[model samples]
Target: MLPRSGDVLHVTRAASVQFLRPITFRVIRVLDWPTYDGWLWLDGYELNASGDAVSRRSIFVQREGLHQVQTAPQHRPHTVRTARRPVARTPVRVG
Candidate 1:
């Protein structure tokens, strides 16, 4: 699900995944920016359920075109599937 216009995102300090780019994850505030396709440079709000904020991160993300994956996340289980393709090809000369 996408974040609401005024929703808040909580970036816990215990987070293991490093989101180097921007994304439209749940629990994040939406802002306005001039960009095409992907999620552009927008402001992020950090807050805890107890009315306290943990940390705020600057973000820019691609909505659909780009592929997003997680490197690591504590206490969470994930399943991924990969494709197998030939790495090299050798030509044979017929006698």
Candidate 2:
């Protein structure tokens, strides 16, 4: 699958020989520079195990070998609360 901006990828040896050690990458953009068919250049950040970007880099890899990582859906707690009635105020006589 073609990667887009904000896509997270699992880059391994399958993608390129340069990546003997696999990496988690977050795509910043796909470079338009011309290259051989089935291969392209990517500009992105190398992500750590914690899913945080460690460094920015440009990578060249085969399109067929790129693996996209599925992100988990965020869960938000839903709660309901009753509205409170306004308090009444007493009027005082002024001299």
Candidate 3:
């Protein structure tokens, strides 16, 4: 889902991935810079256990990595999925 200002997202912290945990956050702004290999920056505040504000910070995440916790069907642990980059090739000379 496309994220916008005031949208809440469920982000998986790098340190907590080993434990499969996620933290809730509210999006304050979306950066306008071009995407770098599918990663972008998002500025927002981290929500506490009671859904309260903690502190504001900028987070880097992939476009597809950010999940809409507000409209998600279900909440669960984050699963890591890796895709292989396709090899680029020019026209091959036939014998």
lDDT digits (tens) for residues 1-95 of candidate 1: 24444443333222223454333333344457776654544355444445454666555544443232322234456778698886898998999
Query: If both were scored by TM-score, which would come out higher, candidate 2 or candidate 3?
Result: 2
Task: Please write out the lDDT profile of model 3 over residues 4-54, one tens digit for every residue.
Answer: 778888887542332157778788888876767767678888898888989
> On a 0 to 100 scale, what is the lDDT of residue 66 in model 1?
28
Whose TM-score is greatest here? 2
Q: Where does candidate 3 have its weakest 10-residue lDDT segment?
A: 13-22
Inter-residue clash pairs, candidate 2:
none
Better by lDDT, candidate 2 or 1: 2
What ordering of candidates by TM-score runs from best to worst?
A: 2, 3, 1
| Model 1: lDDT of residue 67 | 30
lDDT of each: 0.44, 0.90, 0.74
Per-model TM-score on C-alpha atoms: 0.31, 0.73, 0.60
TM-score of candidate 1 versus the correct structure, residues matched by position: 0.31
Model 2 Cα lDDT, one tens digit per residue, 1-95 = 88888889999999999999999998888899999999989999999999988999999999998889954345568878899899999998999
